[model samples]
Target: MIRNKYVLYFFRIIVGGVFIWAGVLKIIDPLGFAQSIANYRLFPAWMAFFLALVIPWIELICGVLLILGLFPRTSALVLSLFLFAFIVLIWISILRGLDIDCGCFGSFSRRVDYTLILVDGILFGMSTILFLSSVRKKV
Candidate 1:
Protein backbone atom coordinates (compact mmCIF):
# COMPACT_ATOMS: atom_id res chain seq x y z
CA MET A 1 0.00 0.00 0.00
CA ILE A 2 1.55 3.24 -1.11
CA ARG A 3 0.64 6.21 0.99
CA ASN A 4 2.63 8.76 -0.92
CA LYS A 5 0.27 11.15 -2.65
CA TYR A 6 2.64 11.86 -5.51
CA VAL A 7 3.19 8.18 -6.16
CA LEU A 8 -0.50 7.42 -6.19
CA TYR A 9 -1.05 10.30 -8.60
CA PHE A 10 1.61 8.88 -10.82
CA PHE A 11 -0.09 5.50 -10.82
CA ARG A 12 -3.39 7.17 -11.55
CA ILE A 13 -1.93 8.90 -14.58
CA ILE A 14 -0.29 5.79 -16.01
CA VAL A 15 -3.25 3.50 -15.47
CA GLY A 16 -5.75 6.09 -16.63
CA GLY A 17 -3.74 7.00 -19.70
CA VAL A 18 -3.32 3.39 -20.75
CA PHE A 19 -7.03 2.68 -20.44
CA ILE A 20 -8.02 5.84 -22.28
CA TRP A 21 -5.68 5.04 -25.14
CA ALA A 22 -6.89 1.46 -25.39
CA GLY A 23 -10.52 2.51 -25.18
CA VAL A 24 -10.08 5.08 -27.93
CA LEU A 25 -8.46 2.57 -30.23
CA LYS A 26 -11.24 0.03 -29.56
CA ILE A 27 -13.82 2.71 -30.11
CA ILE A 28 -12.30 3.24 -33.51
CA ASP A 29 -13.04 -0.36 -34.50
CA PRO A 30 -15.61 -2.31 -32.59
CA LEU A 31 -15.58 -5.24 -34.97
CA GLY A 32 -11.83 -5.47 -34.84
CA PHE A 33 -11.83 -5.49 -31.08
CA ALA A 34 -14.57 -8.10 -31.05
CA GLN A 35 -12.52 -10.29 -33.34
CA SER A 36 -9.57 -9.98 -31.05
CA ILE A 37 -11.70 -11.07 -28.13
CA ALA A 38 -13.05 -13.96 -30.11
CA ASN A 39 -9.58 -15.23 -30.89
CA TYR A 40 -9.26 -16.30 -27.27
CA ARG A 41 -12.02 -18.86 -27.80
CA LEU A 42 -13.29 -18.31 -24.30
CA PHE A 43 -16.54 -16.69 -25.28
CA PRO A 44 -19.23 -17.14 -27.90
CA ALA A 45 -19.33 -14.67 -30.77
CA TRP A 46 -22.29 -12.78 -29.36
CA MET A 47 -20.73 -12.43 -25.91
CA ALA A 48 -17.43 -11.31 -27.39
CA PHE A 49 -19.17 -8.70 -29.47
CA PHE A 50 -21.17 -7.53 -26.52
CA LEU A 51 -18.06 -7.22 -24.39
CA ALA A 52 -16.34 -5.32 -27.16
CA LEU A 53 -19.15 -2.82 -27.32
CA VAL A 54 -19.40 -2.34 -23.57
CA ILE A 55 -16.04 -2.90 -21.90
CA PRO A 56 -14.17 -0.15 -23.66
CA TRP A 57 -16.71 2.37 -22.56
CA ILE A 58 -16.23 1.26 -18.98
CA GLU A 59 -12.50 1.51 -19.38
CA LEU A 60 -12.76 5.00 -20.82
CA ILE A 61 -15.11 6.21 -18.11
CA CYS A 62 -13.07 4.68 -15.30
CA GLY A 63 -9.87 6.09 -16.72
CA VAL A 64 -11.36 9.54 -16.99
CA LEU A 65 -12.76 9.35 -13.50
CA LEU A 66 -9.45 8.11 -12.10
CA ILE A 67 -7.48 10.95 -13.64
CA LEU A 68 -10.02 13.58 -12.76
CA GLY A 69 -9.84 12.49 -9.10
CA LEU A 70 -13.55 11.84 -9.03
CA PHE A 71 -14.49 8.60 -7.33
CA PRO A 72 -10.88 7.50 -7.41
CA ARG A 73 -11.36 4.54 -5.07
CA THR A 74 -14.18 3.10 -7.09
CA SER A 75 -12.27 3.70 -10.29
CA ALA A 76 -9.12 2.09 -9.00
CA LEU A 77 -11.00 -0.87 -7.58
CA VAL A 78 -12.75 -1.43 -10.87
CA LEU A 79 -9.55 -1.25 -12.86
CA SER A 80 -7.88 -3.61 -10.42
CA LEU A 81 -10.66 -6.14 -10.87
CA PHE A 82 -10.52 -5.69 -14.61
CA LEU A 83 -6.79 -6.33 -14.66
CA PHE A 84 -7.21 -9.40 -12.49
CA ALA A 85 -9.62 -10.84 -14.98
CA PHE A 86 -7.25 -10.04 -17.80
CA ILE A 87 -4.46 -11.79 -16.01
CA VAL A 88 -6.63 -14.85 -15.58
CA LEU A 89 -7.63 -14.82 -19.22
CA ILE A 90 -4.06 -14.54 -20.34
CA TRP A 91 -3.04 -17.38 -18.09
CA ILE A 92 -5.78 -19.55 -19.48
CA SER A 93 -4.74 -18.74 -23.02
CA ILE A 94 -1.18 -19.64 -22.24
CA LEU A 95 -2.19 -22.88 -20.64
CA ARG A 96 -4.38 -23.77 -23.59
CA GLY A 97 -1.56 -22.87 -26.01
CA LEU A 98 -3.68 -20.36 -27.84
CA ASP A 99 -1.72 -17.91 -29.93
CA ILE A 100 -3.80 -14.77 -30.02
CA ASP A 101 -3.56 -11.06 -29.56
CA CYS A 102 -4.36 -9.76 -26.08
CA GLY A 103 -6.91 -7.35 -27.45
CA CYS A 104 -5.71 -4.91 -24.85
CA PHE A 105 -4.76 -1.91 -26.93
CA GLY A 106 -7.03 -2.78 -29.78
CA SER A 107 -4.89 -2.98 -32.91
CA PHE A 108 -1.72 -2.33 -30.99
CA SER A 109 -2.10 -5.38 -28.78
CA ARG A 110 0.67 -7.92 -28.71
CA ARG A 111 0.37 -11.66 -28.61
CA VAL A 112 -0.87 -13.23 -25.43
CA ASP A 113 2.36 -14.21 -23.74
CA TYR A 114 4.23 -14.12 -20.48
CA THR A 115 5.52 -10.65 -21.27
CA LEU A 116 2.01 -9.37 -21.59
CA ILE A 117 1.13 -11.04 -18.33
CA LEU A 118 3.95 -9.24 -16.63
CA VAL A 119 2.77 -5.95 -18.04
CA ASP A 120 -0.74 -6.56 -16.79
CA GLY A 121 0.65 -7.56 -13.43
CA ILE A 122 2.44 -4.26 -13.15
CA LEU A 123 -0.72 -2.42 -14.03
CA PHE A 124 -2.55 -4.44 -11.40
CA GLY A 125 0.00 -3.45 -8.81
CA MET A 126 -0.46 0.18 -9.71
CA SER A 127 -4.19 -0.09 -9.35
CA THR A 128 -3.78 -1.87 -6.03
CA ILE A 129 -1.60 0.92 -4.75
CA LEU A 130 -4.05 3.51 -5.92
CA PHE A 131 -6.90 1.65 -4.28
CA LEU A 132 -5.01 1.28 -1.05
CA SER A 133 -4.24 4.96 -0.99
CA SER A 134 -7.85 5.79 -1.55
CA VAL A 135 -8.91 3.49 1.28
CA ARG A 136 -6.37 4.96 3.60
CA LYS A 137 -7.72 8.40 2.95
CA LYS A 138 -11.24 7.36 3.75
CA VAL A 139 -10.21 5.63 6.95
Candidate 2:
Protein backbone atom coordinates (compact mmCIF):
# COMPACT_ATOMS: atom_id res chain seq x y z
CA MET A 1 0.00 0.00 0.00
CA ILE A 2 1.15 3.51 -0.71
CA ARG A 3 1.55 5.72 2.33
CA ASN A 4 2.03 8.95 0.46
CA LYS A 5 -1.12 10.95 -0.07
CA TYR A 6 0.21 12.46 -3.29
CA VAL A 7 0.89 9.04 -4.72
CA LEU A 8 -2.62 7.94 -3.90
CA TYR A 9 -4.06 11.06 -5.47
CA PHE A 10 -2.05 10.40 -8.59
CA PHE A 11 -3.44 6.89 -8.73
CA ARG A 12 -6.94 8.20 -8.21
CA ILE A 13 -6.61 10.73 -11.00
CA ILE A 14 -5.11 8.28 -13.48
CA VAL A 15 -7.59 5.53 -12.81
CA GLY A 16 -10.51 7.90 -12.76
CA GLY A 17 -9.48 9.61 -15.97
CA VAL A 18 -9.00 6.36 -17.84
CA PHE A 19 -12.42 5.13 -16.82
CA ILE A 20 -14.09 8.41 -17.69
CA TRP A 21 -12.54 8.41 -21.12
CA ALA A 22 -13.45 4.79 -21.69
CA GLY A 23 -17.01 5.37 -20.53
CA VAL A 24 -17.49 8.36 -22.79
CA LEU A 25 -16.11 6.50 -25.76
CA LYS A 26 -18.46 3.59 -25.21
CA ILE A 27 -21.40 5.89 -24.59
CA ILE A 28 -20.74 7.52 -27.93
CA ASP A 29 -21.04 4.21 -29.79
CA PRO A 30 -23.09 1.75 -27.81
CA LEU A 31 -23.81 -0.40 -30.83
CA GLY A 32 -20.11 -0.70 -31.46
CA PHE A 33 -19.52 -1.52 -27.84
CA ALA A 34 -22.25 -4.12 -27.98
CA GLN A 35 -20.54 -5.69 -30.93
CA SER A 36 -17.28 -5.71 -29.03
CA ILE A 37 -18.97 -7.48 -26.15
CA ALA A 38 -20.46 -9.96 -28.57
CA ASN A 39 -16.99 -10.64 -29.87
CA TYR A 40 -16.23 -12.25 -26.51
CA ARG A 41 -18.96 -14.83 -27.20
CA LEU A 42 -19.36 -15.46 -23.50
CA PHE A 43 -22.63 -13.63 -23.16
CA PRO A 44 -25.87 -13.67 -25.11
CA ALA A 45 -26.52 -10.88 -27.56
CA TRP A 46 -29.29 -9.41 -25.45
CA MET A 47 -27.06 -9.38 -22.43
CA ALA A 48 -24.34 -7.69 -24.40
CA PHE A 49 -26.74 -5.04 -25.55
CA PHE A 50 -27.98 -4.47 -22.03
CA LEU A 51 -24.48 -4.25 -20.63
CA ALA A 52 -23.51 -1.82 -23.35
CA LEU A 53 -26.40 0.38 -22.37
CA VAL A 54 -25.67 0.37 -18.64
CA ILE A 55 -22.01 -0.27 -17.99
CA PRO A 56 -20.73 2.96 -19.46
CA TRP A 57 -22.98 5.01 -17.19
CA ILE A 58 -21.71 3.11 -14.21
CA GLU A 59 -18.13 3.72 -15.29
CA LEU A 60 -18.75 7.41 -15.85
CA ILE A 61 -20.45 7.91 -12.52
CA CYS A 62 -17.83 5.97 -10.59
CA GLY A 63 -14.99 7.69 -12.36
CA VAL A 64 -16.38 11.13 -11.57
CA LEU A 65 -17.00 10.23 -7.94
CA LEU A 66 -13.49 8.88 -7.60
CA ILE A 67 -11.83 11.95 -9.06
CA LEU A 68 -13.97 14.33 -7.06
CA GLY A 69 -13.22 12.48 -3.82
CA LEU A 70 -16.88 11.80 -3.41
CA PHE A 71 -17.83 8.25 -2.52
CA PRO A 72 -14.27 7.31 -3.20
CA ARG A 73 -14.58 4.00 -1.41
CA THR A 74 -17.62 2.94 -3.34
CA SER A 75 -16.13 4.17 -6.58
CA ALA A 76 -12.89 2.38 -5.94
CA LEU A 77 -14.68 -0.85 -5.06
CA VAL A 78 -16.78 -0.70 -8.22
CA LEU A 79 -13.78 0.01 -10.42
CA SER A 80 -11.74 -2.69 -8.70
CA LEU A 81 -14.44 -5.24 -9.37
CA PHE A 82 -14.69 -4.08 -12.99
CA LEU A 83 -10.94 -4.38 -13.45
CA PHE A 84 -10.95 -7.84 -11.90
CA ALA A 85 -13.66 -8.97 -14.23
CA PHE A 86 -11.87 -7.47 -17.21
CA ILE A 87 -8.64 -9.23 -16.34
CA VAL A 88 -10.43 -12.54 -16.02
CA LEU A 89 -12.27 -12.01 -19.27
CA ILE A 90 -9.08 -11.20 -21.09
CA TRP A 91 -7.42 -14.33 -19.74
CA ILE A 92 -10.39 -16.45 -20.75
CA SER A 93 -10.35 -14.94 -24.21
CA ILE A 94 -6.70 -15.83 -24.55
CA LEU A 95 -7.22 -19.41 -23.41
CA ARG A 96 -10.14 -19.77 -25.79
CA GLY A 97 -8.01 -18.49 -28.69
CA LEU A 98 -10.30 -15.56 -29.23
CA ASP A 99 -8.54 -12.54 -30.61
CA ILE A 100 -10.70 -9.45 -30.35
CA ASP A 101 -10.85 -5.90 -29.12
CA CYS A 102 -11.09 -5.61 -25.35
CA GLY A 103 -14.04 -3.20 -25.56
CA CYS A 104 -12.27 -1.10 -22.96
CA PHE A 105 -12.11 2.06 -25.05
CA GLY A 106 -15.00 1.55 -27.38
CA SER A 107 -13.76 2.10 -30.93
CA PHE A 108 -10.27 2.66 -29.68
CA SER A 109 -10.13 -0.64 -27.85
CA ARG A 110 -7.05 -2.72 -28.32
CA ARG A 111 -6.98 -6.43 -28.94
CA VAL A 112 -7.16 -8.57 -25.84
CA ASP A 113 -3.64 -9.54 -24.94
CA TYR A 114 -1.13 -10.04 -22.14
CA THR A 115 -0.28 -6.34 -22.19
CA LEU A 116 -3.90 -5.48 -21.61
CA ILE A 117 -3.87 -7.77 -18.60
CA LEU A 118 -0.78 -6.06 -17.23
CA VAL A 119 -2.33 -2.61 -17.61
CA ASP A 120 -5.57 -3.69 -16.03
CA GLY A 121 -3.65 -5.42 -13.26
CA ILE A 122 -1.89 -2.22 -12.39
CA LEU A 123 -5.14 -0.27 -12.39
CA PHE A 124 -6.74 -2.99 -10.25
CA GLY A 125 -3.96 -2.67 -7.72
CA MET A 126 -4.40 1.09 -7.60
CA SER A 127 -8.16 0.85 -7.24
CA THR A 128 -7.79 -1.76 -4.48
CA ILE A 129 -5.31 0.41 -2.70
CA LEU A 130 -7.68 3.35 -2.85
CA PHE A 131 -10.44 1.20 -1.43
CA LEU A 132 -8.20 0.06 1.44
CA SER A 133 -7.03 3.55 2.20
CA SER A 134 -10.57 4.83 2.33
CA VAL A 135 -11.43 2.02 4.73
CA ARG A 136 -8.50 2.96 6.91
CA LYS A 137 -9.65 6.56 7.01
CA LYS A 138 -13.06 5.52 8.30
CA VAL A 139 -11.58 3.29 11.02
Candidate 3:
Protein backbone atom coordinates (compact mmCIF):
# COMPACT_ATOMS: atom_id res chain seq x y z
CA MET A 1 0.00 0.00 0.00
CA ILE A 2 1.09 3.58 -0.54
CA ARG A 3 2.18 4.96 2.79
CA ASN A 4 2.83 8.49 1.54
CA LYS A 5 -0.15 10.76 1.39
CA TYR A 6 1.39 12.91 -1.31
CA VAL A 7 1.91 9.96 -3.60
CA LEU A 8 -1.66 8.87 -3.05
CA TYR A 9 -2.96 12.34 -3.79
CA PHE A 10 -0.91 12.50 -6.97
CA PHE A 11 -2.42 9.31 -8.23
CA ARG A 12 -5.88 10.42 -7.25
CA ILE A 13 -5.57 13.72 -9.07
CA ILE A 14 -4.07 12.25 -12.21
CA VAL A 15 -6.65 9.50 -12.48
CA GLY A 16 -9.50 11.74 -11.48
CA GLY A 17 -8.49 14.48 -13.87
CA VAL A 18 -8.23 12.05 -16.75
CA PHE A 19 -11.71 10.71 -16.05
CA ILE A 20 -13.11 14.19 -15.68
CA TRP A 21 -11.67 15.27 -19.01
CA ALA A 22 -12.85 12.15 -20.76
CA GLY A 23 -16.31 12.41 -19.25
CA VAL A 24 -16.71 16.02 -20.24
CA LEU A 25 -15.68 15.27 -23.79
CA LYS A 26 -18.26 12.51 -24.00
CA ILE A 27 -20.95 14.64 -22.44
CA ILE A 28 -20.31 17.34 -24.99
CA ASP A 29 -21.01 15.06 -27.94
CA PRO A 30 -23.06 12.12 -26.81
CA LEU A 31 -24.19 11.27 -30.31
CA GLY A 32 -20.60 10.93 -31.42
CA PHE A 33 -19.75 8.78 -28.45
CA ALA A 34 -22.82 6.67 -29.16
CA GLN A 35 -21.64 6.25 -32.69
CA SER A 36 -18.24 5.16 -31.50
CA ILE A 37 -19.83 2.61 -29.21
CA ALA A 38 -21.97 1.29 -32.03
CA ASN A 39 -18.84 0.94 -34.16
CA TYR A 40 -17.59 -1.69 -31.77
CA ARG A 41 -20.54 -3.89 -32.69
CA LEU A 42 -20.33 -5.58 -29.32
CA PHE A 43 -23.67 -4.28 -28.06
CA PRO A 44 -26.99 -3.46 -29.59
CA ALA A 45 -27.59 0.10 -30.74
CA TRP A 46 -30.15 0.68 -27.97
CA MET A 47 -27.70 -0.49 -25.34
CA ALA A 48 -24.99 1.74 -26.76
CA PHE A 49 -27.39 4.69 -26.74
CA PHE A 50 -28.29 4.10 -23.12
CA LEU A 51 -24.68 3.64 -22.07
CA ALA A 52 -23.63 6.82 -23.84
CA LEU A 53 -26.31 8.69 -21.92
CA VAL A 54 -25.35 7.29 -18.52
CA ILE A 55 -21.66 6.37 -18.45
CA PRO A 56 -20.28 9.90 -18.80
CA TRP A 57 -22.23 11.15 -15.78
CA ILE A 58 -21.00 8.21 -13.76
CA GLU A 59 -17.41 8.99 -14.76
CA LEU A 60 -17.78 12.67 -13.98
CA ILE A 61 -19.35 12.12 -10.56
CA CYS A 62 -16.84 9.48 -9.49
CA GLY A 63 -13.95 11.63 -10.71
CA VAL A 64 -15.19 14.62 -8.76
CA LEU A 65 -15.56 12.48 -5.67
CA LEU A 66 -12.07 11.14 -6.11
CA ILE A 67 -10.46 14.55 -6.51
CA LEU A 68 -12.38 15.87 -3.52
CA GLY A 69 -11.04 12.97 -1.45
CA LEU A 70 -14.59 12.05 -0.52
CA PHE A 71 -15.48 8.37 -0.57
CA PRO A 72 -12.10 7.76 -2.13
CA ARG A 73 -12.38 4.02 -1.84
CA THR A 74 -15.76 3.86 -3.52
CA SER A 75 -14.70 6.24 -6.24
CA ALA A 76 -11.50 4.38 -6.89
CA LEU A 77 -13.33 1.06 -6.97
CA VAL A 78 -15.88 2.35 -9.46
CA LEU A 79 -13.19 3.77 -11.73
CA SER A 80 -11.15 0.63 -11.40
CA LEU A 81 -14.14 -1.48 -12.39
CA PHE A 82 -14.69 0.75 -15.39
CA LEU A 83 -11.06 0.36 -16.40
CA PHE A 84 -11.31 -3.40 -16.06
CA ALA A 85 -14.41 -3.49 -18.22
CA PHE A 86 -12.73 -1.26 -20.77
CA ILE A 87 -9.69 -3.49 -20.86
CA VAL A 88 -11.86 -6.49 -21.53
CA LEU A 89 -13.80 -4.70 -24.21
CA ILE A 90 -10.62 -3.57 -25.89
CA TRP A 91 -9.22 -7.08 -25.90
CA ILE A 92 -12.41 -8.43 -27.35
CA SER A 93 -12.42 -5.81 -30.04
CA ILE A 94 -8.87 -6.65 -30.97
CA LEU A 95 -9.63 -10.32 -31.14
CA ARG A 96 -12.59 -9.65 -33.37
CA GLY A 97 -10.37 -7.51 -35.63
CA LEU A 98 -12.58 -4.48 -35.28
CA ASP A 99 -10.68 -1.32 -36.08
CA ILE A 100 -12.61 1.43 -34.34
CA ASP A 101 -12.10 4.38 -32.06
CA CYS A 102 -12.04 3.59 -28.35
CA GLY A 103 -14.83 6.10 -27.66
CA CYS A 104 -12.89 7.05 -24.55
CA PHE A 105 -12.79 10.77 -25.18
CA GLY A 106 -15.81 11.09 -27.43
CA SER A 107 -14.67 12.80 -30.62
CA PHE A 108 -11.07 12.83 -29.46
CA SER A 109 -10.79 9.10 -28.96
CA ARG A 110 -7.89 7.13 -30.38
CA ARG A 111 -8.09 3.92 -32.29
CA VAL A 112 -8.54 0.78 -30.23
CA ASP A 113 -5.10 -0.69 -30.18
CA TYR A 114 -2.45 -2.26 -27.99
CA THR A 115 -1.35 1.21 -26.87
CA LEU A 116 -4.80 1.88 -25.50
CA ILE A 117 -4.62 -1.39 -23.56
CA LEU A 118 -1.35 -0.27 -22.04
CA VAL A 119 -2.75 3.09 -21.02
CA ASP A 120 -5.92 1.66 -19.54
CA GLY A 121 -3.90 -1.03 -17.77
CA ILE A 122 -1.80 1.62 -16.07
CA LEU A 123 -4.92 3.54 -14.99
CA PHE A 124 -6.47 0.34 -13.68
CA GLY A 125 -3.38 -0.34 -11.62
CA MET A 126 -3.42 3.15 -10.19
CA SER A 127 -7.10 3.01 -9.26
CA THR A 128 -6.61 -0.43 -7.71
CA ILE A 129 -3.76 0.88 -5.61
CA LEU A 130 -5.90 3.79 -4.48
CA PHE A 131 -8.70 1.43 -3.56
CA LEU A 132 -6.37 -0.83 -1.57
CA SER A 133 -4.62 1.98 0.27
CA SER A 134 -7.91 3.60 1.20
CA VAL A 135 -9.16 0.24 2.49
CA ARG A 136 -6.01 -0.14 4.53
CA LYS A 137 -6.54 3.23 6.18
CA LYS A 138 -10.07 2.27 7.20
CA VAL A 139 -8.73 -0.77 8.95
Candidate 4:
Protein backbone atom coordinates (compact mmCIF):
# COMPACT_ATOMS: atom_id res chain seq x y z
CA MET A 1 0.00 0.00 0.00
CA ILE A 2 2.82 2.38 0.84
CA ARG A 3 4.54 1.61 -2.44
CA ASN A 4 1.31 2.12 -4.31
CA LYS A 5 0.83 5.48 -2.63
CA TYR A 6 4.31 6.55 -3.66
CA VAL A 7 3.73 5.53 -7.24
CA LEU A 8 0.42 7.34 -7.30
CA TYR A 9 2.02 10.46 -5.92
CA PHE A 10 4.66 10.40 -8.63
CA PHE A 11 2.12 9.96 -11.41
CA ARG A 12 -0.07 12.65 -9.89
CA ILE A 13 2.69 15.20 -9.91
CA ILE A 14 3.76 14.47 -13.47
CA VAL A 15 0.23 14.44 -14.84
CA GLY A 16 -0.80 17.54 -12.90
CA GLY A 17 2.23 19.49 -14.02
CA VAL A 18 1.68 18.49 -17.64
CA PHE A 19 -1.98 19.59 -17.62
CA ILE A 20 -1.26 22.83 -15.81
CA TRP A 21 1.45 23.75 -18.28
CA ALA A 22 -0.71 22.84 -21.23
CA GLY A 23 -3.65 24.90 -19.90
CA VAL A 24 -1.50 27.91 -19.22
CA LEU A 25 -0.02 27.81 -22.69
CA LYS A 26 -3.42 27.58 -24.32
CA ILE A 27 -4.85 30.34 -22.11
CA ILE A 28 -2.09 32.63 -23.26
CA ASP A 29 -3.41 32.49 -26.81
CA PRO A 30 -7.05 31.49 -27.00
CA LEU A 31 -7.35 32.38 -30.66
CA GLY A 32 -4.49 30.13 -31.61
CA PHE A 33 -5.94 27.39 -29.52
CA ALA A 34 -9.27 27.80 -31.20
CA GLN A 35 -7.60 27.60 -34.56
CA SER A 36 -5.84 24.44 -33.56
CA ILE A 37 -9.08 22.84 -32.43
CA ALA A 38 -10.71 23.91 -35.65
CA ASN A 39 -7.94 22.26 -37.58
CA TYR A 40 -9.10 18.93 -36.26
CA ARG A 41 -12.35 19.48 -38.16
CA LEU A 42 -14.17 17.63 -35.46
CA PHE A 43 -16.44 20.42 -34.32
CA PRO A 44 -18.17 23.46 -35.72
CA ALA A 45 -16.43 26.81 -35.53
CA TRP A 46 -18.59 28.12 -32.68
CA MET A 47 -18.25 24.91 -30.74
CA ALA A 48 -14.49 25.02 -31.18
CA PHE A 49 -14.39 28.61 -29.98
CA PHE A 50 -16.43 27.81 -26.88
CA LEU A 51 -14.41 24.73 -26.11
CA ALA A 52 -11.23 26.72 -26.46
CA LEU A 53 -12.54 29.11 -23.86
CA VAL A 54 -13.68 26.51 -21.33
CA ILE A 55 -11.45 23.48 -21.75
CA PRO A 56 -8.22 25.09 -20.65
CA TRP A 57 -9.85 26.41 -17.51
CA ILE A 58 -11.15 22.94 -16.76
CA GLU A 59 -7.73 21.44 -17.30
CA LEU A 60 -6.07 24.02 -15.08
CA ILE A 61 -8.58 23.56 -12.26
CA CYS A 62 -8.50 19.76 -12.35
CA GLY A 63 -4.70 19.71 -12.57
CA VAL A 64 -4.26 21.97 -9.59
CA LEU A 65 -6.76 20.01 -7.54
CA LEU A 66 -5.14 16.72 -8.48
CA ILE A 67 -1.69 17.87 -7.44
CA LEU A 68 -2.97 19.29 -4.15
CA GLY A 69 -4.86 16.07 -3.39
CA LEU A 70 -8.11 18.00 -3.18
CA PHE A 71 -11.03 16.15 -4.68
CA PRO A 72 -8.51 13.86 -6.28
CA ARG A 73 -11.08 11.36 -7.42
CA THR A 74 -13.18 13.90 -9.23
CA SER A 75 -10.20 15.67 -10.70
CA ALA A 76 -8.60 12.46 -11.85
CA LEU A 77 -11.86 11.25 -13.35
CA VAL A 78 -12.37 14.44 -15.29
CA LEU A 79 -8.81 14.51 -16.52
CA SER A 80 -9.04 10.86 -17.51
CA LEU A 81 -12.20 11.50 -19.50
CA PHE A 82 -10.56 14.39 -21.28
CA LEU A 83 -7.55 12.30 -22.10
CA PHE A 84 -9.75 9.54 -23.45
CA ALA A 85 -11.55 12.00 -25.68
CA PHE A 86 -8.23 13.31 -26.94
CA ILE A 87 -7.03 9.82 -27.72
CA VAL A 88 -10.14 9.17 -29.74
CA LEU A 89 -9.79 12.44 -31.62
CA ILE A 90 -6.15 11.77 -32.38
CA TRP A 91 -7.02 8.30 -33.62
CA ILE A 92 -9.65 9.68 -35.96
CA SER A 93 -7.25 12.25 -37.31
CA ILE A 94 -4.59 9.63 -37.93
CA LEU A 95 -7.02 7.29 -39.62
CA ARG A 96 -8.21 10.08 -41.86
CA GLY A 97 -4.58 10.70 -42.84
CA LEU A 98 -4.77 14.21 -41.48
CA ASP A 99 -1.17 14.94 -40.71
CA ILE A 100 -1.48 17.82 -38.28
CA ASP A 101 -0.31 19.04 -34.94
CA CYS A 102 -2.19 17.36 -32.09
CA GLY A 103 -2.85 20.69 -30.37
CA CYS A 104 -2.62 18.72 -27.16
CA PHE A 105 -0.01 20.83 -25.45
CA GLY A 106 -0.83 24.14 -26.98
CA SER A 107 1.87 25.28 -29.42
CA PHE A 108 4.39 22.74 -28.18
CA SER A 109 2.44 19.86 -29.65
CA ARG A 110 3.60 17.13 -31.97
CA ARG A 111 1.97 15.60 -35.00
CA VAL A 112 -0.85 13.17 -34.43
CA ASP A 113 0.67 9.69 -34.34
CA TYR A 114 0.90 6.43 -32.48
CA THR A 115 3.33 7.91 -29.96
CA LEU A 116 0.78 10.47 -28.90
CA ILE A 117 -1.81 7.74 -28.61
CA LEU A 118 0.49 5.80 -26.32
CA VAL A 119 1.27 8.81 -24.19
CA ASP A 120 -2.40 9.61 -23.71
CA GLY A 121 -3.08 5.98 -23.02
CA ILE A 122 -0.54 5.97 -20.21
CA LEU A 123 -1.98 9.15 -18.81
CA PHE A 124 -5.46 7.68 -18.90
CA GLY A 125 -4.27 4.59 -17.08
CA MET A 126 -2.60 6.63 -14.37
CA SER A 127 -5.63 8.83 -13.95
CA THR A 128 -7.90 5.82 -13.71
CA ILE A 129 -5.74 4.26 -11.03
CA LEU A 130 -5.66 7.48 -9.09
CA PHE A 131 -9.42 7.84 -9.23
CA LEU A 132 -10.03 4.26 -8.17
CA SER A 133 -7.57 4.43 -5.33
CA SER A 134 -9.17 7.56 -4.01
CA VAL A 135 -12.59 5.96 -4.11
CA ARG A 136 -11.40 2.82 -2.33
CA LYS A 137 -9.74 4.86 0.39
CA LYS A 138 -12.91 6.82 0.99
CA VAL A 139 -14.91 3.62 1.39
lDDT of 1: 0.93
Candidate 1 worst ten-residue window by lDDT: 1-10
* 1-139 per-residue lDDT for model 3 (tens digits): 6789999999999999999999999999999989988998978999999999999999999999999999999999999999999999999999999988999997788999999999999999999999999999988
lDDT of each: 0.93, 0.96, 0.94, 0.91
Candidate 1, residues 50-115, lDDT tens digits: the string is: 999999999999999999999999999999999999999999999999988999997798999999
Candidates sorted on lDDT, descending: 2, 3, 1, 4
What does candidate 4 score on TM?
0.96
Supply candidate 4's per-residue lDDT for 91.
94
Of the two candidates 1 and 3, the one with more favorable lDDT, higher being better, is 3
Q: Candidate 4: deviation at residue 41, Å?
A: 0.7
Model 2 scores worst on lDDT over the 10 consecutive residues at 1-10
lDDT of 2: 0.96
Best model per TM-score: 2
Give TM-scores for every candidate, taking all chains together and pairing residue i with residue i: 0.97, 0.98, 0.98, 0.96
- lDDT string for model 2 (7-124, tens) is 9999999999999999999999999999999999999999999999999999999999999999999999999999999999999999999989999998788999999999999999
Off by over 4 Å in 1: none
Better of 1 and 4 by lDDT: 1
